[model samples]
Target chain A: MGLKEFCFKKSLWVFHLSAGSCNNCDIEILDLLTPRYDIERFGMKLVGSIRHADVLLVTGIVTNKTKSRVLEIYSQASKPVLVIAIGACPCTGGIFTSSYNFAGPLDKVIPVDAYIPGCPPKPEAMLAGVVKLLKSKNRE
Target chain B: MGKKTIVPIGPYHPLLEEPEFFKLYCDGEKVVDMEWETGYNHRGIEKICESKTFEQVFYVVERICGICSTSHPFAYANAVESIPGVEIPVRAKLIRSIVGELERVHSHLLWVGLAGHFLGYNTVFMWAWKYREPILDMFEIITGNRNSYAMFTIGGVRRDISEENADKLLKVLMDAKKKISLLTGAVMDDPVIHARLKGVAVLTAKDIHDFGAIGPTARASGVDIDIRRDDPYAAYEMVDWKVITAKEGDIFAKAEVRLMEMFESISIIKQCLELLKKENKGDIKVKVKEIPPGIGIGRAEAPRGEVFHFVKSDGSNSPVRHKIRAPSYNCITTFRRSCIGGTISDAAIATAAVDPCYCCTERMTQVYDIKTGKKMMNAAELIKLSQKKTEEIRAKGDKND
Candidate 1:
């Protein structure tokens, strides 16, 4: 396949990583894949292995204990990867921000591309972010 | 003892959103030994109780887990109210029942979606979640917050459903019923789903007794135990609903039990809404009074299963000791028995099908890259990076054009 054809035709495989979140954010992320938003229409698919993914959708605040696991997944992805932070907690630490257990914001660790803000953002917003990211990537 | 390969699922596993960990020792593909470690997501909520008043603690407890947020406050309020002998208005009880069942409907549907994702059935996952939006919209209309509906007070609910809201709820309920039927039909009839789930993780009725399981896990295994039916609380006694049970303790049976329970929840919500219109409102919340110095236990059927809250009050403004027990805790205990002969992938779906909420069970932990010796991206940074890349690609496209 030609370079441009390969880049455009190959769908973006997204891997979801939960640092620590109430299931609210996780469910909303899952909802993006559902028929209402159908993230797949934009060629966004949830991948089981980080090795195959182009986008890493991380939810929840990254605490001290889960630090290694989250970093491990980000390192596993191939180059030119995009990351989407999915909730208030991960974006700005939400309600659990100042707690002694937590480490800090998600950006403190890896490069972030989009922030879908909500106590937990709605599924539509999540899909919008995914499509926006893919469209931008294809344009490049 | 022979050497066993150990795999740790969660603290950052896909089966659950929360951060609990399960270390399973496998013999080839079969899980031979399983033990769970919690405390990753625990914010020391009980510790927070020491600084807040009884009224404020009500709000704090509600933040325990978003899915069961209302139930935590409801159970705590029940414990605090009984201490003062404060009589809750009948209408208020009906309203609480309505809110509780609505929560159950959304939570179970959410679980159904997660189960579908775990089983490699993305269509069902998407369909179930799309259907759940309406139920959550109903919650937003009534209580404001979609996830943690702060609806309860010490003696009763904070908000009352007007006739207008009730009518809207009825319509929503009708839509939910139709959508749920389509979703459940897809789950039951799909050969792919049946192959992945049916008879994959078997838990016998006897296993339920041995593990001291409660809620859907127990019900699916023929252990006829429902806290609502056996120990009637709030308006559950007045509502006409049946405790659904399944003879087969496999993942499919568990799925069936959860799907059928949605209908029962809808039925209970209908009865409560109807009762609400006929009854006159006297008081939505009783006056805050010091709870008598004694320990009390409050149990309610949360969406996942029975959530038991034990409070020890020393006639003080706050509880002396509070122990919160989520039904998933009991259900996770049964995983050893269930995953013994299953493949690694089967274990993932089966554990997820149990609807484990690790946030309540464990504290949050940070995950890093084991191979690269670098930090992992959190949700916000990932979103930003995704956006930036998209923007850069779009700019290049415009220039080319």
Candidate 2:
């Protein structure tokens, strides 16, 4: 196996990017770390810096102010980064799609490796999305 | 301006859930002053609400914050209900209080967890969040979702508290209360928590009034102003719970008020459930055939503070203009009082003490030396600085022991 694959096949560190979310998904991501779900068992953890990440979990519908920043961060990530869009807002601008500043459905702005769908996807759904993406399994 | 380093806290950060910016000007270890700004998460929600019908506005308002999902819609519903010749069913009113109080219990626990995490007390964070899960589970059981419970509608609630589920809710609440009290007792008795939080970032009543602050931020200062008790909306007037307040406006006092209020919320929900059981069979909504032209103002006490919504209708299906004043609009300014004259280490926790819910605190904030204009610190490093200080203090205490 390649060095990159060897390094990330077992452990995944994610950097969270909120283009412009309502914070439901953001808190849910934190919930994934809390004891109830304990996603740490899966060897997936949220890191503060994008440079240390193998996966980029993006939340929220992209507002105009955040769109450029989202693009910048996505570009800065190392190649072989998996971008998973969390929540309906980031997936298709959700309810705020009609709003003037709403510039999202994340894939429109940047390539997405996975999409976890929900107003705010449950922590389980988010975990499943990540696992699926790692295997290059499903697309929805 | 002689020689101050800017400890920038945002634009984006994993540590800070909200995506906003705070430029803390520091003279040595002390924060001399600071400037805060937000707008990164502004989706023009109020502007968008104008296009949707009055009936559809609740779903839109529900997205304001995942933590306080019911607050905005609750306020908006009251605004719509306030339109002349509108009256909701009695059962609906009780349901509103049940949901509101449940929200308080969950939010306070969430804050407690985050506060503990910031203070480097990982165990406390873990314990608090573990207790918080049952509350979310109850929400999921009752409303079919955990975060944003879309129970509120213009005329009344969309769902009814069935006789069977009411008993289930009460059972879940008791389990939550037991766990929460255990957490609260642990938090209250902890000496390290007392040292770190007591008298840290004291915002006096005068400072509170000057900043127009509300909710726990104000109540912690002994400012007895709760929209629930004062305005008497929904089933608040019918309930027997008293507002929890403290004389000192420090972080500890804020923590105390929030912890104490969780019990009050539990009590309120219990009372509402009992009342619902007694007078259980009633309409959950009053069908408003049409909305007449006029302006209506409504306020609901969110977990953060008073959520105010003003709706202007012009004899149409959709509102002409809908104005919302989130509690953060008032409470966020209070940071001017809290952050100034404090150590840079105390800065993050101090700002978080008010629970500003700043939407713009969303991205990776680039910190600079300000003078050299070169990147000096990332968000994690700054948060680490705060956690490190707490650890040092704890280590010294251990040495003294």
Best by DockQ: 2
Off by over 4 Å in 1: A1-13, A51-55, A74-84, A107-116, A125-140, B1-16, B20-23, B189-196, B363-401
Q: Each model's TM-score?
A: 0.82, 0.91
Each model's lDDT comes to: 0.79, 0.86
Candidate no. 1 TM-score: 0.82
Encode model 1's per-residue lDDT on B355-401: one tens digit a residue.
77776665233445669946776878868988999999999999999
Candidate 2 C-alpha lDDT tens digits along A4-31: 5665678789888877888899989999
Across B315-396, the per-residue lDDT of candidate 2 in tens digits comes to: 9999998888888788888888888999988988998888878652222234456588566787789899889999999999
| Candidate number achieving the greatest TM-score relative to the actual structure | 2
User: After superposition, which runs of candidate 2 have C-alpha atoms over 4 Å from their true positions?
Assistant: A137-140, B360-401
